[model samples]
Target: MLCKIPDIAKGVISLFASGRLSTEDYREIMQPQIESYRKSTGKTYIYVEADVLLEGWQHQSLAGSGQVQLPNFDALVLVGGPDWFGNAVRLMGPFMQGEVAWYPLEQKALAIQWIAARTDSCN
Candidate 1:
């Protein structure tokens, strides 16, 4: 399930995913934010909490679905997930156009701080 994490900050949308991730959930919950980001010229931020990496998800398809809008992101913070997932993202982070940070579940505050610093969102 994907649930919106509300009241975090202005211009920032946070989402939490549990159990197995679904493309349908992604579309219903996340795609709107991505669309809003794409339509707006203003800076915005995103935070995703998908702590576990469950089997049966095609990671590439989920990622590929957002490729067009990825470059327009102001900043994104991801909290938790497996070490390998974090490592893979970190490896590609430097090459991406926007700032991307990953934090352990315990360091969620730091992830919020990092993304807040990059956005004009009043948190």
Candidate 2:
């Protein structure tokens, strides 16, 4: 399932998802949150906490808006997913305009704090 983490500060968008994920989850759910945050802050810190990232049909949706709008984010904190998820994220490094890092799910608080601190430094 895909849903937003509540009460995060403005410019900070955190999503918690696990189990199965689909292209629609990104296109429908995650994309809107990114767009909304971009419109408000012009810069963002995105935190994604997922167990097993992509499942059947989910990989296809990973293609985001190419290089366009890449500068929307300042930092990206990803937590708890399979090794493939980490690799995939690193592969997107050249395309994404944010600093990316990963951590175990148990260190979610640390990941969040890192993004918060990095977001402040980037400003």
TM-scores, all models, native as reference: 0.74, 0.72
Single out the weakest 10-residue window by summed lDDT for candidate 2.
62-71
- What value does the lDDT take at residue 45 in candidate 2? 81
Runs off by more than 4 Å, candidate 2:
7-10, 52-72, 90-95
| Model 1: lDDT of residue 52 | 72
Query: Which regions of candidate 1 are displaced past 4 Å?
Result: 37-41, 53-56, 59-71, 121-123
**Compared with the true structure, what per-residue lDDT tens digits does model 1 show for residues 1-123?**
667877355567788866666676666777787678556735657888776753324476467666323435778888887766678678988977778888988998888788877765433
Candidate 1 structure lDDT: 0.71
Quantify all predictions' global Cα lDDT against the true fold: 0.71, 0.71
lDDT of 2 by residue, 1-123 (tens): 677777344467888877676656666777888888778767778887877643423444445734223245778878888777777777876677668887777887888788888767755
| True-structure lDDT of candidate 2 | 0.71
- For all predictions, the C-alpha RMSD in Å is 3.5, 3.6
